[model samples]
Target: MTSILQVLIDAFALGSLYALSALAIGLVFGIMRLINFAQGDLITIGGYALIVPSSQMVAELFIGDWPWVAMVPAIVAICVAAALLTERIAFRPIRDADPATLLITSFAVSFFIQNLILLVYTGRPKAAGIFPGLSQSVTLAEGLTVPGIQLVTSAVAIVLLAGLAFFLKRTRTGTEMRAVAEDFTMARLLGVRSNRVIMLAFALAGALAGTVAVLLVAQTGVLDFRMGVFLAVYAFFATVLGGMNSLVGAAVGGYVVGGLSVVLQAFLPDDLRPYRDAFLFGIVILLLLWRPQGLVVGKAGRERV
Candidate 1:
């Protein structure tokens, strides 16, 4: 039916955003073996970076026709810097520490960033000021309408995913990154600079998070300081469902989660709507129990030091 197709489009659009965000999380985990809880906040950072500049109508100062391109670079740069700084300040010292310590530190860093934003920007939601054409709907089939922005978002996500695949497969730095993931000590012995590689990982993750933020703003048209909190949960779930260290797995997991969410929303009765997240959470719990490493195989032959 047309309605079903519409739902599928909606799900894929949302899932693409999730895929990018999850890729950010997965990238950090793949290299440093640390979950950057602040990953979601990097998204929040990207959102606000645009919100603040556009709110002032500052885009008018730049080229009117393609102001968005400028915003994209500026926002992504700010987010990448924030991510790198967070890693250096909060994560680098604890790099060799136990997983528990890293996790707690991540949580703490997340809270610190969120609260800092809240204090500076207030807790109110602000419109993200996306391009005008983004919200336009297109008739894909009889009785089916899909948002123009959603299509663009999905296309962008696919392109970025493909580009990422190419980078990981063909580049020397990418090979070194994979080598580091497989065996950090051996990678170090091979003259792989752990510091530089890890920083690059964080940068890539930041760029992905920034892109997701732009897509999210395009879809929702508004953002709140607390937006990062729920997104973090979603990203964590995607990471669990996909293989934690596999980029492709993260993308697949994101779409799967998005599809499952659409299916549930479409079929769930009114009474169960409120508890949908609870059910999904239960599913994540089960998935983690069954395959703690995630659905896809992570970095091949990882050994705990």
Candidate 2:
């Protein structure tokens, strides 16, 4: 029972990361119907923003040395600025383009960012001591030990999810966001400023990306150029699995995927352990075959304004 409980805790912590990433993806998709794959690069940017650009393995920690009070807001601001800039420069011009065009643009922008990082920082892994103090573990009842970082991850996830729910349900800007997500043209007709709503979505997603970056660096204590790739990929699957059109579906899907992946790893036989992801994805395939539309049904069709 203790082992099972431990598994559940691990699962939720892992799920929280996926859930946050998926929410970022789902937010922009809701507003623009564009899959901004470049979000991963945004995570990379967040990671790089911490230390000064250097080819040396032990890159100098710049802003990362600041107190959390200052570090977080600064990194978040950088990501937010990048997101808004991307929206204005890349997405706005192609607003009327077909989905395929937008997708290609996203890929282009992703590579652009990746290459830019390579130019600035070089393609080398660097050690990062992000919040080293979070490494401490806490003992709970029944002698169960929980990592402090995991606790922080879960807490942040729950708070953000609850706060997001409230923002979407209660605020005027939130209502505008929802209206834009449902039907862009109609929302604009209803007096919702399309640009503002879209910008807001981008900013929110940027903030999520920044948060993910911090959580990842804190957990791994390492920085690399491609760090955010798998995260973006997993989050994409989570969004699809949950139903791309619904934010709630995205979060639920992330949790389901996170939980199942951990279980598959924990319970699989020795030889098959290496193939845990393969097995988990095989199950995902089965799940998708059974419900291609998604675990939760979403918008029937997306129409352009």
Per-candidate local distance difference test: 0.81, 0.89
Model 2 residue runs over 4 Å out of place are 54-58, 299-305
RMSD to true structure for each model, in Å: 3.0, 2.2
Total colliding residue pairs, candidate 2: 0
lDDT (Cα, tens digit) per residue for candidate 2, span 7-82: 8998999999999999999999999999999999888888888998556544689999999999988888888999
Q: Encode model 1's per-residue lDDT on 9-33: one tens digit a residue.
A: 8789878887888888888988888
Candidate 1, residue 241: CA error in Å? 1.3
In TM-score terms, candidate 1 sits at 0.91
Per-model TM-score on C-alpha atoms: 0.91, 0.95
TM-score of 2: 0.95
The deviation in Å at residue 120 for candidate 1 is 1.2
Highest lDDT, which number? 2
Model 1: which ten-residue window has the lowest total lDDT?
57-66
Clashing pairs in 2: none
